[model samples]
Target: MYRWPFISVVLIIAILLVLAFVLNLSIGEVWLNPFQLFFSENLQSAILISEFRLPRAIAAVLVGSALSLSGLMMQTLFRNPIAGPYVLGISSGSVLGVSLVILGGSIFSAEFLSSNSAIIIAALVGGLAMMFILLMVLKIIKDIMTLLIVGMMFGAFATSVSSILQYFSPGFQVKAFVLWTFGSLSKVDYPQIYWMISFIVLALFFVVLSLKGLNLLTLGTSQLEQFGIKTKRLHFIILLATALLTSSVTAFCGPIGFIGVIVPHISKKILKTSNHWRLMPVSMMIGAFIMLVSEMLTHLPGSGMVLPINSVTAFIGIPFILWILFKPLKNEI
Candidate 1:
């Protein structure tokens, strides 16, 4: 299913993802070294490492994997290089659902449930609800461009809904919502990171199984159906996986951008092929690398204050997006 040469690239990206995890762990405010684990005297250090940095680092890794894989699925399913997790208003829906819990005007205060996991679960449901709408539209309208437009308009509609909620929300709630928009990986704590990783891993396992189908779909729909592929069923499965993966990440980490939309394109360019068997892991590595680097920048000594994760990502992502606009690929489809 994969060229031997492409497999090498996938293996290299795996190594780099591992290194990115290490870098993410080492450079946080409470800086740590994993080798100190055996020294009982360094128990405090271990606590700081395990309780704080590791969870946040793990959040970055899982969120990165979620976004990257989501992007890969979108690009393949939509048959459009520019498609991303946010395109379908899914994240906007998640944010709006969580905003009700966060923005305590007493109406939705009880909804908070005082659990990060609950908040995440709420957001996931909201995102999936929106995704289901888009999938239904896909069934009704077979035009890819039309589906994209629908997703965008749906996002605008979601934003309007969020704005109305914000109007009645307390100032503190609005501030919290604003912070979520900025997006920080630092919100993850020791205990909950495990859950984030668990869901992300489960979602991705399903996506990976669809790699062969993804490759066939990339070759074009008719070609896949010619080989007895059930295009509609495959599309639903992949889109559902994308919705699950993206919803989980955006629910916890807020709506991250750039890397998801751009990373797959970069992977395709580097691998010189449209093979998802190679592309999936490559996109994950690049996404993880981007997040880890954003995490590292938070440790810049003289910056005085840490920058927002989404801010750094958007800054890095936009230029590449412009480059993509400037240099169209010869045979992207």
Candidate 2:
């Protein structure tokens, strides 16, 4: 089995993240040295850095880390290797929320949904609602497989509703909703990035507090109970943290996928341990690194065409997923 010391893994991923961050900022329409651009006297270069590229790069890091952490926590909570915000329908809930605002013309005014705040609020509300429902279902359903099925049903329901809404929506509103569904990093600006940072920071605090509880959880509820851990409360706090992390990303980035699932698996494989202490930071750094690289790929230098960030991730993700499905699990992390 491949393994590295915890510090070495973190340091290596951190360095990669830094390089990828700089590389992401340097790509796009015109290749410019980002560090040079920052100090350059050219107002045009300054505007491009400060107003556009910088925010997009930061948003990529933020979205990647949030989604990765969310996936890790959910996998731990469910004790399922394949569990994630996207697979479990949490992102679908955010989509439902946004749909109500953008596609539900009879309910929410187009002018009102036009504001970024409204869209963000809608996403958070919808994601939290789904989280709450899943928590309730957890209380009644002891089977993890059944719980996952319920989550998929909820996601399907949300998607079906969004489709129906789209069917009746004005062409402009539908187009706007469709574009948002494509997912984006450039769509997030400075103000939205500030909000995303706040949400992720708060979620990370909860995660730090829940670290021991999460470790206990991986050992099973009986072990946690024997250790005097309050399982239900811990579950709530962890799920809440996941919801906050996932909702913020989906709200701003339009539900980017695969990072949450892939990063954790890769982290586990490299670390060869289940300790949350090591798993958390490594997963985050790896996620951010992947996102930055994905962003750079989406905007290849000298290519006037820019691909949707979601499509790039899917291209990276689908192969990894197929590998996981077919790969031998005798040494599974």
What's the TM-score of each model vs. the native?
0.88, 0.92
lDDT of 1 by residue, 1-333 (tens): 344587677778778777777767667555556455435377787776677777787788777767978988887877776788787778887876776556643346674443566666667777878888978987986555577788788888878877887888777768777887787787887556666677677777778767778888776653466787776667767777888788878877888888788888878877877768777878888788778877777666644477888887888889988888777786443
CA displacement after TM-score superposition, residue 332 of candidate 1 (Å): 3.9
The number of the candidate with the highest TM-score is: 2
For candidate 1, the per-residue lDDT at 302 reads: 47
lDDT of 2 by residue, 1-333 (tens): 556878888888888898888878778898888678667888987888889999999999998888989899888888767778676688899999988888885445656675667877898889879988988987786555566788899999999999999988888888888878888899788999999999999999999989999888777553466688876667768877888898889988898888888888988888888899989988898989999998888976677788988899999998998887788355553
The reply for model 2, stretches above 4 Å from the true place, is 106-112, 138-146, 220-223, 331-333
The C-alpha lDDT values of all candidates are 0.75, 0.84
CA shift of 320, model 2, Å: 0.2
C-alpha lDDT of residue 59 in model 1: 82
Score candidate 2 by TM-score against the native.
Answer: 0.92
